[model samples]
Target: ELKVEQNPLFLSMQEGKNYTIYCNYSTTSDRLYWYRQDPGKSLESLFVLLSNGAVKQEGRLMASLDTKARLSTLHITAAVHDLSATYFCAVDKSYGQNFVFGPGTRLSVLP
Candidate 1:
């Protein structure tokens, strides 16, 4: 069975601060995705790390994957109140298999 875990399940940071959220999985998977969800809202796709050493960034958020270590990271730079949301990391073992998701990290960015 594949297991996924995330650190600091809940985070509270002030605006302009920076932090990183970590995701670790039990299996070897080259495909990983990062997502965001606002309270009571649907999930939003953030990044797709398709291979080892893959990294993606948009605006103030960046995501990276290290397949050999079965680890993925989401880094937030200069956070803002608008960035307050629950973040998730999902690993896909195969094309047709269900994605294993990490327990989301709920982030609250104070102004």
Candidate 2:
């Protein structure tokens, strides 16, 4: 059975602060995906790490994966109010069909 876990399930940050959210999985995966969600909304894809050491960045958000350790990280740089949202990391191992998602990290960026 595959399980995805995320740390710091809740976070509160001030503007210009930085933090990292971690995702760990029980099974091996060649691809991992990061997504974001606002309250009562659907998820928006943020990053797709396809290989070891793969990294993606956009604005204040960055994500990377280390497949060998079954770990992935989402780093927040200089977080702002606009970056406040719930983030999730998903592991896909069933030929792009099944995906196990981590418990989302709810981030609240204060002014």
Candidate 3:
């Protein structure tokens, strides 16, 4: 077990579509984060789900975390071409900046 797991490394979502991606982890973690990245660009903060049942959303993206189950989710609503990018969920193991990232979800939102 590599501590964290994410499924369907790639997604091709049509415009106006909706989808959900999952993240599962082992052991206890301090924080979970969802980040978006454009091609060859730095990460853009999406959501930071802190505790159990913590949910946060912005624009067409929503994220939720369940600490007890060590799980997290990122949901996309009404996808658009501008949403094409990579999404990553990282788990903070240490109190500091130590983080483990999922393989990443590569999304291609086509019109």
lDDT of each: 0.93, 0.93, 0.88
Number of backbone-clashing residue pairs for each candidate, in the order shown: 0, 0, 0
List the candidates' TM-scores in order. 0.96, 0.97, 0.92
Give candidate 1 misplaced runs (Cα > 4 Å): none
Alpha-carbon RMSD to native, per candidate: 0.9, 0.8, 1.4
lDDT of 2 by residue, 11-105 (tens): 99999999999999998897999999999999999998889999999998899999999999999999999999999999997756478999999
For model 3, residues 1-111, the per-residue Cα lDDT tens digits are: 338888679999899999999998897874899888999899998898777889998999889999888999998899889989999999988857688999898999988
lDDT of 1 by residue, 1-111 (tens): 889999889999999999999999998789999999999999999998898999999999999999999999999999999999999999896656479889999999999
Give the distance in Å from residue 59's predicted Cα in candidate 1 to where it truly belongs: 0.3
Clashing pairs in 3: none
Clashes of 2: 0
Prediction 3 global C-alpha lDDT: 0.88
